[model samples]
Target chain A: MSTTIKVARPVDWTGIFFAVVLTLVIVVPLLVVGTWAFTNVWRFPSVIPQEFGLKFWYQTLARADVWSSITMSLTLATTVTLISAVICLPAAYAFARMDFPGRDILFFSFLAGHAFPKFGLLVAIAGIFLQLNLIGTFWGVVLIQLVGTLLFMIWIPVAAFQSVDRRMEEAARDVGASPFRVFWSITLPQAGPTIAAALLLSFVGTFYETEGAWLIGAPQVRTLPVLMISFINNQPVIQYGAVLSVLLWVPSFIALLFARRVVNSGSFAKGFGA
Target chain B: MSVLTIKDVTKLFPGGTKAVDSFSLEVADGELVCLLGPSGSGKSTLLRMVGGFETPSAGLIAIDGEDITRMPPEKRPTGMVFQSHALWTHMDVFKNLAFGLKLRRLPATEIKRKVEAVLELVGLGGYGSRRVTQLSGGQQQRVALARSLVLEPKILLLDEPFASLDQHLRERLREEVRDIQQRVGITTLFVTHGQDEALSMADRIVVMRDGGTEQIDRPDVVYRNPQTPFVAGFIGTMNLLEGTVANGIFTRASFSHPLAVADGPATLAIRPEALDVTPAEPGAAKVHRVTDYGTHGLLDLDLPDDTRLKAMVSHPAQYRHGMGVNLTPRAVSAYRNNAQIFRSEA
Candidate 1:
């Protein structure tokens, strides 16, 4: 009889340290918010809530205003994802495969939006949105979200498409595939997951956006982040804000899982090299 | 009529590099021509222009007497095997082969038949269902070949297709490619930097250098009677000796030969195999180095005047370093300022 033996891998201390740090930095906050959403009465520096109930989660869900904010944020995020993907695909393709005068400078300029804090830029753009009568409108928030996500979508696929082999497209063309067909069949398929990653990243970015959504989407068209901010300021307890935060975190967590899967699939370059 | 004709083609890149310059060649139907050159010699650029991947800055390309210079690659009737094989990693073998036929809107039955036929032709009859990533390098190469040939293109262009394989596999694959090409009788333009590959595979060879055509002729003629010094030196190793030709007699400082050609200040080019070396008590040449392969060896010798000569010897074990040896030219090719003046009769 033959038996199989399982071998154990040595513990990675550095990885474990990073994992713990990440959990503390990210997961612990979510857990605290979730606990706060259920706690009827809780105090900081106390390990557990003195009292517990579902009143805050129930109240937040039943609010017509909260429902409207959720709906508006969802619509704005979907619109931004669609628009940014459409605009970023061609821009990324050109940056990856073509050469033009001042190309690097132009591409770098696309990334210049990240050099400064968004709060500063939103403050300056608030005046323009005000003059255009776009402040507090759904389109106004969507426009700001599109600009924020375009930099990410364009940059991600540019690096992804550059990693894709140019010879595949050339081979497709040699075998009678048109420019459109070559992109549809070769370039897009090879970089499909990366493009997906970009879209999900854009969706997540727009979903969690606070500064621009607060500055541009307040009062008239209340997005989730704006409502949560107002709730936190107006209410003495943090439970209502924690309830809204947990609701918003759900879709972002799902998007992150999908992006991680797309990245870890790692099957794009399997047959190219020996 | 020629199947393909490139007339005065020149490709000037954006940064002032002339990748291909004034290159012209006519490929007849069912003829396999090899473009042989070192790297950066513009051989690939010429092939790309034919395949429509590149557009020549100046000149025209025509197929079957119709101008295709302005046509896009997909509209041209050509197939190319890339150096990297470029198989679709995400696709199964069948999907990869059926992609072009599907683009052409062929019927399912016809696509299946053609795909199966080419799969069998390339010796991969049952490989259609396999994922490309699971296949070996040689298998992937065949799949790449089958993918292109299934389309039945009017012309086939191969760009160093076997460069990535092991040496043994490369030799076998190259022979398989030659056999398939001949059996199909497709007009082929093969690009290679290897002289041995060009010599073995091409019906006619086009020797290129510095984005220009050096010589274009049959393999035997290009080898036996090169038109220029560059062609002679580039095709294989050749020793260049400076001399003067007068009244059908060529004379060097310490050697003389009776030629049957014109008189001028000339350069003599002799291939290593054309020089006969033998041991002598007192000889003008002294053996400097000897490198032996299993079948043959190379003897690098120097004359008293500091002229270095290399000769191939069949009896490699008999030669040693710093030994005195006598050399006699069995045949010599004379070139005057890059133009061929004469070659000794065989």
Candidate 2:
């Protein structure tokens, strides 16, 4: 008779440990904030809230200033995404396909938006906005937000366009489609998914952008992130800040859902030049 | 009537390298001409020039007697099939075929009819609704061919269309393409590096080397009467012997043959089948290797001065390695300064 020795599988302790740490890192903050948003009274030394209700939610939603800021943020994000797409997509295509003098240098210059300390750059741009009499205007907010969008709009779409197969375009041309028709029919559709992913990133990034809006549109335009900063600083109630913080996460959460679908479609990786 | 004429078309890339230099070709109506050469031999560049994907640095290109030298590819009445199928993955097979016709603003019914007919012709009749990515490699290639043929262009250019397929598929597809070209009666220009493909498919093979024409002849003529040493060496297996031809005789180290040529230094090229080998004692050449390929056998022989020669024989089992053999030239083509000087009849 042959004896069979049973082998015991080793537990992945390191993997489990890291998974627990990561889960706590992400979930604990949200859990604490959520608790604060609902709590009416959680005095010092109390491990848990003594009283919890919907009072903070009602108070945050009732403010006219919070309502205006929400509207302003949405409008700025939408406008900036649209304008950035219109201007930067064409530039991205050219950067990907065409050759010209100093093209490499010029394309890399879009990175200047995020390469420096953004607040310092925003202060410098605020000086120009002041001289141009553009300070405290919505267009000033739009222009500054546009700067935040350039890296996502240009770099990602450039990768998307570059990944498109050129032979497909030539095949279209051989079939009697003009250059413009080939681009419309062949090139754009092939690059569409990745470009869509880039647009999502640009819109979500613009929505959460704070420095440009605060520096340029102060006292006139207050986006949600800018409003949340003030709410945290001035508001005596901790629930108001917590409520605003949760509100700030709404667009990002929704964007993440859409982003998952886009990533699953496999174009998101190509947009990052994978 | 010639459907396409390329006269002295040359492509000098910006770096001053001439990819196609003073190349000229004329394709008869309904004829299939092949530009045959090794890579970098400018066969594809010439095809691209005709298809308008490339501009010739100098010279003229015409289709049906109209100059299309400066015409864009879309404006030119020419269709090209690339080596890669280049099918639009976003569209189904049906939409891919219909796209060109729709651009020409053909009626919807007519577009459907034409697309369906071409699909049938390419043996993909019921594959119209299938996504391009779902089909096999050979199916994608057929779709590519169907896409070009449905346009009914004045000239068709194929740049190594069967190059990506396996050997068996390549042979089958080349025969199918040749059949379709004949059935459609469309003038075609095929560029390929496979000599077997050129010999089997082309009505005329244009042998090219170093961006220039070496020989242009019928397949049989190109095989039998190669005009240049490059063509002789490239088209098939040939045993080249360095020798001198004088007084109606060719002579090398220990071998001599009767020839009629004005001779100085000359290279003699002979096909393996054209050399007759006989077993002999203490012969000038010794059998080095023998390979039996079922239908025919190949014998590799080494001369006294170590010049190796290959001969195709009907019976390879009779010759043993290290055995002595005498070689007799049944037919030979002599070349002088890269050009064929004389070819003796068997």
Candidate 3:
């Protein structure tokens, strides 16, 4: 009898092809945006920009409204994140660790924020906000942004808290630690990484949110994304819109870096039940 | 003096299931009593009640004559070693052991000294700085034990601490835990489902069934003189023959035993070692199978009345399948209505 030996292939062409396709799908648009942010003149039929300078960057930075919009976006996002965390985190813990009547129904109700078309929900809430004289106010924008954060702040942290080992808490209690002490020392530290990741995601999502801010804070509360819409709509120079777009990516880019660290530490997957 | 006392404690869950039913126990200052049972036997629930993790529907738990039935777990002067070890993954071994001590307002130097002493006692002398997540299963369990022992709690409750390990590791850790318990001389209540664990380690074993205790006695007494039929069938291999006792003789079909008891329907329980098996022509029983287990052997015998019995033979090489064998009971216990009525001398 003769024996046959087969060698394994070294390179997988199918994998390589998909990798290149995916990279182009994500990177191509960002590359075009980067190119337009610096281009001063680009004529027709040119593969690359015909002229490049810092004129648009100087113009966007010199405007006082641009700086106020930047400040407004940060303040609104920070406020929304802080208030949502305070309101939602304890509720998440209770939903995760305690058993009560109507627990599942109450927990899944947070999904109502994202279940339907968000604009439809916004339009409905905007009617109520107008009736309450909350339109064109900071708190109105804050309340609307809070709707977007409920799912992340409640669902992800609930999973994080649920994944913590109950036995560890029991061990702490058995060895003379109070209930509050056990939560602070044992439970919180274990769930901290995943909760931090969720917070960052909520902040970045609220920062880039446009529809709510534009509808509720049209006259007074001008956020970065709201201002970016105006720049894209009314400004004659395309570079003005491109520069704001690039500036808008800054916080998200930093948050992505921090989120990657959190994911790499191995808690992000646990937060989503992966 | 008894260090811990539990009186008529019961736990009725919300669904009306009685997990524990008026269980009572008393432990001396340095005694190790094991609550042994299968699943749903309420051993763990009883242990949890002692640890103050569960409130009894009706009972009183006291340590040193002070009622602690309503006190929370943290104030109960007890420490528990869970089956999962439950070591904090974020802390090193030193911090894990020192946490309870720090909470007691002990000085940092005193905490360090106590932690080091316990670490040495559990045989992990210099593993204080290693992260708990990096340790092996046995080492993590030792850290858990050390964590509880450092507090010097009035009672130590272990709920199947070695249940998750492999067989070899389980035996070794069982001996180690018993040695540490004796050396420290702490009142300990250990709960386990393994018969070997309860038999070899406990000063007295509480055999539980269906939310209540069947027997509470020393290991040898529980093994040799099981008061109830459940304990007999649960603790070890026993040949239970259904028969009737009449005029000092227990008779079942063609087989009979000389048992001194009242005339009634009875269950004759005899250990495998107590039955002697010998080759004979036209015997009452036939050797159905023989298994040689290196140190000893087991013989499965079939009686003429279709009754199956097990007997231990020291020399199995002399017996063959289909051979006629005679069974003689060296000792036996007779039970009526699930309770013992008579026992024979060896």
Number of the top-ranking candidate, with lDDT as the measure? 3
Error of 2 at B298 (Å): 1.5
RMSD of each: 5.2, 2.9, 3.3
Regions of model 2 farther than 4 Å from truth: A1-27, A38-41, A48-55, A253-274
lDDT (tens digit, per residue) of candidate 3 on A11-120: 98999999999989989988998999999898889999999998899999999999999999999999999999999888888888999999878877888888899898
Better of 2 and 3 by TM-score: 2
DockQ of model 3 vs. true complex: 0.83
TM-scores of the candidates, chain A only: 0.83, 0.88, 0.89
Sort the predicted structures by TM-score, highest score first. Answer: 2, 3, 1
Per-residue accuracy of model 2 over A1-274 as CA lDDT, tens digit each: 9999989989999999999999999999999998999998899899899999989899899999999999999899899999999999888888889999998788778878889998888899999999998899999999988988888788877877787888899999988898878878998899887787778888889889888888899989999899999988997888998998888788788778767866786655655556
lDDT per residue for candidate 1 within B50-139, as digits (tens), equals: 988888999999889889998999888888999999999988999999999998999999999999999999999988999999999999
Per-residue lDDT of candidate 1, residues A217-248 (tens digit): 77687888888989999988799999898888
Fraction of native contacts under 8 Å reproduced by each candidate: 0.84, 0.86, 0.91
Q: Per-model i-RMS in Å?
A: 0.8, 0.6, 0.6
Scored by DockQ, the top model is: 3
lDDT of 1 at B189: 96
Is 1 or 3 the stronger prediction by DockQ? 3
Give the clashing pairs for model 1.
Answer: none
Tens-digit per-residue lDDT, B138-209, candidate 3: 999999999999988899999999988999999999999999999999999999999999999999999999
